[model samples]
Structure formats: C-alpha cells, structure tokens
Target chain A: DQQVKQNSPSLSVQEGRISILNCDYTNSMFDYFLWYKKYPAEGPTFLISISSIKDKNEDGRFTVFLNKSAKHLSLHIVPSQPGDSAVYFCAASKRNYGQNFVFGPGTRLSVLP
Target chain B: DAGVTQSPTHLIKTRGQQVTLRCSPKSGHDTVSWYQQALGQGPQFIFQYYEEEERQRGNFPDRFSGHQFPNYSSELNVNALLLGDSALYLCASSLGEVNQPQHFGDGTRLSIL
Candidate 1:
C-alpha cells in the first residue's frame, strides 16, 4: 500500500502566478514532510520542509503548509517562474527513525510565460 | 565542495547477473542513503548506512545489499538481477543530525535486458 499519495499527475500555471501542489499520507508516524523539485535526467532537489509541530513554513517564494490532523500537506510558490516548472515530489519521514523517506508519485508542474 | 557523487552513470545487465554501484557522499557528510526510482514514480528507500553500518532498510529483498567504507563512501550490490530491477538508483547524503536535508546525486540508470 502507498503510504503517500499525490493525486494530481500534472499542473500548469502562468508566469507570475501562484502554483500549489498537494500531498497526503496515511502513516501517522510521519512527523517530517518535505518537497523536492526535479528536472529530467537529474536528481530531485530539496525545496522546503515542514515539521508536524508547525502548521506552516515559508522560505522566500516557497511555502509549505502541514495539516497533521488531516494527514495532508501542500507546497505553494508565489510569482511562479518558468524555472519552477518541473516534477514536484512530496516525501515524509518519522523523526528519530532511520530517516528513510517515503515519496509520492509526483506532480509535473509547468509554468508558462 | 562536491555534492553527492555516484559512479557509472549507466549500466546494463542480464538476468541473474550481479551489479555493484558506488557513491561518495558530499563534503563532511557522514551518512548515505540509497533509493530506487522507477519510471513515472517517485523514489523508494532501499537502505541507509552510517558509521560503516546498516542502520535501516526498506522492504526491498535480500538481493539488495550495501556497504559503507570508513571514508563514508557507500556501495550498493544487487545479486540475481531481474528485469524488474531496472530503475534509477539514487544516492543521498546528509549529516547525522536528525531532520537535516539530504543532498542527492544525479543517480545511476540501470537497465536489465
């Protein structure tokens, strides 16, 4: 069974617009959530993360929000640029555990000019 | 400083053959984790090594094994490879600190023919 799920296969947004990606998990043990952006033929790059203790974490144009009660989290990018277009993956891991991250299927986001 | 580095960018093997992949962690990093990503899917954890020991492993089969050197580099060995073993193998490195972000390599693409 998949512990994490990203139902959206793809998303498209215009330049300078806002892009939102959502993810859900079934494992309650997960206390740390992360977002990664990947380009074709390259490894996923770490974007932002949020701990279960906080409802939101923001860094520059990127923001991550966690709703532990709903077992859901989302990533938001304001003033999205074409450079932001890529596959976005959501991953989760439990604290003090082995630090093995569980990733979702991913969502392809395209930011148009 | 160099980021996580992986060897043999690509490899091809037949059924029942054995293959080994190598990784060098980022500068000053002491932990390494291995993951497998299939086409159109996110990465799945295989195992993690720290202090020259296997600290944790995922649900992968015994056919998948690994080793960590005193220098903090790592190697992944797969025995009796099957067509299903074809995928992108990613190596991520991080500090031993909990909740630290991991840096990933471009990954080695393995093809089983």
Candidate 2:
C-alpha cells in the first residue's frame, strides 16, 4: 500500500508562470515533509520542507503549504523557469521514530520557454 | 564543497550475482542513507547508517545490506540480484541533527539481466 500519493503524473507550465504540484498521504503520524527535485541522471535534490508545527514554509521561489487535517501538501514555484523542468517528489517521515522517509510517486513538471 | 559522490556510475549484473555500490558523503556529514528508484517512480528508502551502525531500515529484504566506514563513507551490497533489482541506486548524506535535509549523489544505475 502506498502511504504517500502524488495524483498528477505530469504537469506543464509556461515560463514565468506559477507551477503547483500536489501530494497526499494516508498516515497522520508523519510530522516532517520534504520536497525534492530531480533531473535526468541525477539524484533528487532537496528543495523545501515543512514541519507539522507550521502550515507553510517558503524558500526563495519555492513555497510548500501543508494541511494537516486533509493530509495534503502542495509545492508552489513562482515565476517558473525552464531550468525548473524536472521530477518533483514528496516525502514524509515521523520525526521521533527515526524512521526512513516514505516517498510518493514523482510528478514530472515541464516548463516551456 | 564536494557533494555526495557515488562510484561506478552504471553496472550490469545477472540473476544470482552479487553487486556492491559505494558512496562518499558530503563534507562533514556523518549520516548516510540509501534509496532505490525504479523507472517512473520516486525513490524508496533502503536503509540508513550512522556512527558505523545501521540505525534504521526500510521494508527491503535481507538481500539488501550496507556498511558504513569510520570515515563516514558507505557501501551497499545486494546478494542474489534479480531482474527486479534493476534500478537507480541513490546515496544521501546529512548531519546527525534532528531534522536536517539530505544531500544526494548523481546515483548509480544498476541493470540486471
């Protein structure tokens, strides 16, 4: 059973537009959430993260919003650039349990110039 | 600073063969984690090593094992490789802090025949 799910398999956005990627999880015990971006032949790069204590976290052009009650999170990239085209993965873990992260199927985002 | 580095960018093996992959963590990082990424899917955690010990592991079987050196580098060993083992193997490193983001390497692509 997949504990984390990214419903959208792919997304396309024009350069300078805003791109939004969504994720959902079934486990409520997950307290830390992270987003990673990956390019072909490269490992996923850590982008942004949000703890359950806060509803949102923003890093430069990337912002992640979490809704605890809904068990959903979204990553927003404003003024998306062509360089932003890549696969984005959402991962979650319980902070206190020292458990490994559970990652969702990634969403491929294509930024068209 | 040099980021996480993995060895043998690609490898090919047959069923029942054994393979070993190596990783050198980012500068000053003390923790290492391993993940497997299948085509069109996000990475799945295999295990983590800290202080030369296996701190946590995912649902992967005994066929997957790892070792961490005193220098903080790590190695992943897979025994009795099957076709299903074909995937991208990723290594991530981080500080032993409570909630630090992980830095990943380019990964080693393993193909099983």
Considering summed lDDT, which 10 consecutive residues are worst modelled in model 1 chain B?
B94-103
Residue B60 CA displacement from its true place in model 1, Å? 0.7
Tens-digit lDDT track for model 2 on B1-113?
99999999999999999999999999999999999999988899999999999999998999999999999999999999999999999999998876788889999999999
TM-score of chain B of 2: 0.99
Error of 2 at A112 (Å): 1.2
Predicted candidate 2 versus true structure: per-residue lDDT over A1-113, tens digit per residue: 99999999999999999999999999999999999999998889999999999999999999999999999999999989999999999999988756478999999999999
Residues A1-113, candidate 1: write the lDDT tens digits: 99999999999999999999999999999998999999998999999988888999999999999999899999999989999999999999999796889999999999999
> Per-prediction fnat values?
0.80, 0.71
Q: Which portions of model 1 miss their true places by more than 4 Å? A: none
Q: Which whole-number lDDT from 0 to 100 does residue B105 have in model 1?
A: 98
| Candidate 2 structure, TM-score to reference | 0.98
Query: Model 2 reproduces what portion of true contacts?
Result: 0.71
Instruction: Please give the C-alpha DockQ score of model 2.
Output: 0.76
